[model samples]
Target chain A: MSENMGNKVSLELYRTQLLARYFEQRASDLFLENLVKGTNHLALGQEAVAAGFGVAMNKSDYTYCTYRGHTHTLVRGAPVAPMLGELMGRECGILGGKGGSMHLTSVEHGAMGSYAIIGAQLCIALGSAWSAQYLGTDQVTTVFFGDGTTNIGTFHEALNMAAVWKLPVVFVCENNLYMEYTPIGKVTAVEHPGADRASAYGLDSIIVDGNDADAVYHAAQDAYARARAGDGPSLIECKTYRHQGHSRADPGKYRPKEEVEAWFARDPISMYRLRMMENGFTDEDLTEMETEIQNTIDEATEVAKLSPVPSLDIIDKDVWADGGSAWRN
Target chain B: MAQLTYREAVAEGIAQEMRRDNNVVFLGEDIAAAGGVFKATVGLFEEFGEKRVIDTPISENAILGAAMGAAMTGLKPIAEIMFSDFLAVCWDMVVNEIAKARYMTNGQVKVPLVIRTANGGGSRFGAQHSQSVENWAMAVPGIKVVAPSNPSDVKGLLAAAIRDPDPVLFFEHKSLYAMKGEVPNGEHVLELGKASVLRQGDDATIVALAAMVPRAVKAAEILATKGIEVTVVDVRSLVPLDTQTILAETVKTGRLFTVEENPRLCGWGSEISSIVTEECFYDLDAPVIRITTPHVPLPSSDNLEDATIPTVERIVETILKNMG
Candidate 1:
């Protein structure tokens, strides 16, 4: 279990976690300040999964996620500027400012796309995996979903098909212990859905401490290797938690204050940062990284603020690839 | 010139496109071994092999969803839905995802997928197996709905839809699959929005689509025998309707009849009537006529089902009445 033969993975984890933390904290502040409008699902406490898996993933590999995708986008190499511009509804955003926070994409970085609809990306990712295999490519796709999505029909169908076809996919379950407000225990009778069901499909699965960046990085490395080798799909259940409420508007009033405080106690970013220091990272070295990230985010925010908004004239465009024009009217 | 059945032409088109591009592949129920229930994809499995001509489980949603994903990732997929009526089960995959993904992504992604299915009422397959649902797809944005009535049109449009960079719902009428037509021997492709005039006349313009084209052709023959000339227009594609030709014909004839096998209310005929009325109101000499099935489920009995859908006799009688 302790594959910590070196400190390289731990350092990379610290880097990603740092990005996720600063990114979400800035987004949360902007949302509260009314600069960032619309629904914002901050991946505050769940930075470890995105950063850890992203660090463990190859450049050719792909990642698909649910509405909590800002962290995924940033970890997958999306520039902070265009992403911030997208969040601000600027034309230079990833989705051309059409899709806000919920629907963000940077296919060039191997992040196929993200969707707001729960469990929708599962089937889409499976299809992409199928394409990869059919085209005789070594690329693999990692599809991330919440514990709540495991109950959806698409989740079961996609998994079943992926298993039968042995698609080059790694299904990642970011079990943050809550789907909106409902707890995992309240919904699923099985303690670990990903691992338990993966065995039924004759595929390998594992449960890892999602907060432990090294653990996620190692597990993801295994899954990605198996998928790229055409050995079929693997499932990883990352038992993590979201530090903030599901969206920015809610205060998570349904859960007790102590529970939120309890999760906040095991903050993935702070834990990774401590690990970085323990591994001989100097205070000045950490400060330089922090300052660099801050300055980059500042420039991104400025670019997003100045980007033009898409006009309504072109709103009716791109409805169809050909000039057939389905939504012209 | 070569004579081929509609199903044969469709399979030929698939084979032709797959031969042209390595990125083109196909999948559907029994499409591999069984060669499809209608045999539209017959011999494709052997020719293309399992990786290209895949036989998927009886999950319509998975088949369509996987095809959409494949298309997005750089492959052109031709998916078979068996029958058009089963589209109801996979509506979410077709309408919500496949039809809207390109637009939703602001054209960043191109879902070059063709959903080929047997449509229209014939062979007494009843309401379940036999029903025209082209209108349902035409209502959705981001999708090109083309219903080919003849073997030549099938090959041309199927190739065109496969080559195009959009999600196309290509409906091959169940009755027309076996109907023979003269098709060119060499490669041929049809444009999506162009309508082909089957026959020319001066009294009235008879606009028809899919299976109704043959019926309207017969009606035009009858109208000619009675010295009442009727123009017949086959609308190859419904979504991007050939409004230019339709309006031109309607303006010259000053009378029109829209024929379809779907229900009369909110059918493609209704849309044609609305568009014609809006654009050619000044040239109208008589109210537009629509020949469609009754507002009821398709009957199981052959005679009963035939009575519901527009027929050659029914079309001829309607045309004569409009001539008044």
Candidate 2:
């Protein structure tokens, strides 16, 4: 396949990537200013990967993601209002005010769910894919994880099952180089975490520029096509970085300023905007898009703040069978 | 009606389900060509082929997780975790994901998955492999826990588990695999959450589960020979425990002795004792007695393991002491 053929990200995809960055930045600001509680793992630099994967899939396809999942949720068309409302702990949240930021789901749009547990979504995603194939549905399940998650045993186990059973799943490894505070090299001896490992299980694996939205999108598209066509599962490792700390609290004192700035130079949102302009987006059009995103963010925040907190009865709810009756019983 | 061993009954139940529904599949470490480590899935691969009976990698988490996924997608998947002890490896999938998916999704999703594993300590397997870990499953919500002590119960309960809309953990005692009993020649589906009275009497009640049911029966016979009547109740399902039957028996007999193979502290026996004490305290002639394994790791030695577990000798003595 040619490098650019069927690999070029469309203008609409570019807007989504830009909006992901803008909304996450706004979320980070609101969080740091004490306007938001709980934790927030901003998908700042990794917007391209989420946008790319979302662009290559239909709404009917399934997606399961990790805690740092704001971009993935948005790209899957989770209304920004519910996303902000979730961060604000409101009744209007996506999970009906049950699951907070990390735990989000929109079953109608085929967003199977996103989990907070590290490497937990891997098995769940594989399960969903098995369900799709068992039910004879064309939908494929894509699970996104960080480079740190590759070190987990569940990741290896999940991949092996997907390969052995030939389940319809696309293992998206967004290698952000850090599993929390520690770097990937300190943990594992192997350099290419995803590239060589998938071969051990006879999986068709590939490495792509995680920052380049189009590359991730095209890789996902090929993998999805294979999965939908019953060619088994594939692992797509996208080398990327996290622009913010692992969580809302960490100031990222572990990283050097020069390294942080070097990564900032490759910010996915800016690159996508530049590409959009080069592809004939006027300055006025870019300005309008930016303003439109800002307005949406503003409206979302306002609406979320007024939304009611989950009812007091919900605290003991959804934890068990029969509406969590067993909890108190 | 043809007689069948507990193992054959379970295997037949799975086969019948697979034949009825194309979406029903079996996945485990050696369930496919190897016919399962215990041969519970023997001849299934020949009948259903690879797509249905799949031998997965040595990953308990993957096996259950894949089953959960398949169940979520509308497939009725029966995943075999070789031993109840190994269920720990996949607890996150079982307890967190499969058990909680229905309620978490606000009833939008249902994980119609069955995780079958062998429990109990009669095989003299070491502590790791011999534990009767039914309490852990009972503690979790949105998941039904069933322990079938006989061949007929195995066939009936397994079919019910497959047909149920929620996730079910089917615990078949490893020692009872070869035990033979009469079963209906045709399909038999037992209702879950209902306990069956194995032997009827009026003097006292013996509530037991899985392997302990047979032990309780022998204890009842000994008590009868001593001029004491004893009722033996097999508390099959643990999660939606048959509290009504237990209460009724306890109220009628005015005496109760619960038996289980697990550790004494907070064991299933302890739960039964508590329930009987709380709901039928006035009806009780004496405090509920519990005959359970000692609060220690299962010893590997034959003599030590025998001493640790609750036997008919111990159950008879406990019932006599409680009745007196």
Candidate 3:
């Protein structure tokens, strides 16, 4: 994959990364202003991971993400208005306004879900992969988790099952360096948290410099091809950094200011923009992309605010698929 | 009529379902080639092959989540948890993920899966393996709980459980595996929440669930010899408790006995007692009698463990004492 602006794919890759950045900025501003209710975890520095996976995956492929997953779902093509509506607690949100930010799901786009529990999505992704295998479909499933979730038991269990059954799945650990304020160095024993564990399951691990969208996209594409070929699951540890605190409420005082500044210098969006410029893209072209993304975000916010909250008459709605829930009389 | 053991009945139900629907698959530890610890899933691996009859690693959490995902993606998976005591291993997947997915996602996903586990303690399987956890299933919402008594009920209920478009916990008693009875021919599917009235009488109503149903029927027979005509009602499914059958029977005799294998305090028996009391307290000639296992961990010793569980004599004695 060429990074030069002469390649339309590279331009789109830059567009995706920027789209994530602009969306995060808009979401961050709205959340800080108290317009977006609940605790929304932002993916400011991890834009390449979500966007690159978006670029690499096939339309039929499934993606399961963590709570910091607005970018993941957006990259998977979830409706922007409903995604924003979810943050604003509107009835028209992706999850009917019940799941808030942590549980946005778009089954149509193969964006399975983003569970709040650390390693829970691992099992869910493995299950879907098992389904694809059992039904003899060529679809591949990818699960995104943070470095913190690698410590969870389900991570090992899901990987083991996937290895044993040769399930068509990819375990993508976005090494954001911090597991919810506690730094990875303090808790994890190995330098490569997920890659070290991959050998234990008899699978090879692919370590990628996560800041580069091209690298991640290529790695994920390779994993998809391998999985679709029935070679079993692989672990891709994307070494990335979290720009903001874990959530809106968390402060970044725990990190060394110098380390934070160094990581910010290698920011994925800025790096991609420079590559696009060197490849002969004009400043106006980048500005046009940013303006278009901003309009999209703005319209989503407006549409969400215009939508009414769900009616009280249907308060006990959707509790059961068979309508057997008796929570309300 | 052919006599089918409880295990055979369950296997038959699964086989019939698999034969009927290609999506119905059986998965658990030792269930594939080993054919389940109690042989309940015997010959299924040969019949359905490895694809449907999956042998999984000893990871309940993964299996439960896998079953949920498979169910969501067009497979009706029947996951066996080996023992009901092991339900704790993957409690969150059931209580939080599977049970709450439908409601949390606003009914976007229906958990069309069944968790079948061997329950109860009659063969001295010890504390870890011998728990009757019907209360645990009842405590969680958005999931159905079904415990069948005999071969016929097991066959029907297991069939119904796999086909239901929601999560169902099918508690099969290990003690009743070898217990044989006449099962209906061919395909059998029972309703989810319906209860079967084994016997009818006016003196009193005894509500028994799972393996306790036969014992209650025996106690009722013993009571009849002593000039008592108590009705024996089999409470097949707990979550959708057949309150109509229970209410009608309890209202007829004005006396109800809630019997189960769980411990006495705050168990499913108490839930039934409260349900009857709240619905028709005035109709009761006596306080609802709850004949449950003693509040103690099951002992491995045969005699001691038997003493902890409610016996046929104990049920007869309780019925006689509670007689108005």
Candidate DockQ values, in order, are: 0.52, 0.44, 0.57
RMSD of each: 2.6, 2.9, 2.0
- lDDT, candidate 1, A1-329, per-residue tens: 13464666666677778877887887887777777789899888888899888988888777888789999988989888888877887787777767788877887888777777777788888788998998888889898999888887777778888988999998999988887887777888688867777777787768988888888888988888888877899888998888778898778778778877877777777777777778778778778888888887878788877889877765777777753355312
On DockQ, who's better, 1 or 3?
3
TM-score of chain A of 2: 0.93
Best by DockQ: 3
Worst 10 residues of 1 chain A by lDDT: A320-329
Better of 1 and 2 by lDDT: 1
Per-prediction TM-score to the true structure, in the order listed:
0.95, 0.94, 0.97
What is the RMSD of candidate 1? 2.6
Q: Model 2, B30: alpha-carbon shift in Å? A: 1.8
Choose 2 or 3, whichever is better by lDDT: 3
Cα deviation in Å at residue A270, candidate 1?
1.6
lDDT (C-alpha) at residue A159 in model 2? 89
Model 3 chain A weakest lDDT span, ten residues long: A320-329
Put down candidate 3 lDDT per residue, B1-324, tens digits, no spaces: 569999999889999999999988778899989888999989999988988999999998898988988887778999999999999888878888888787777667667999999999898989999999988999888888999999998999999988888899999998999999999897788887888899998899999998899999999999999999999999899977888888889999999998899987788989889888999999999999999998888998989988888899999999998785
Backbone collisions counted per model = 0, 2, 0
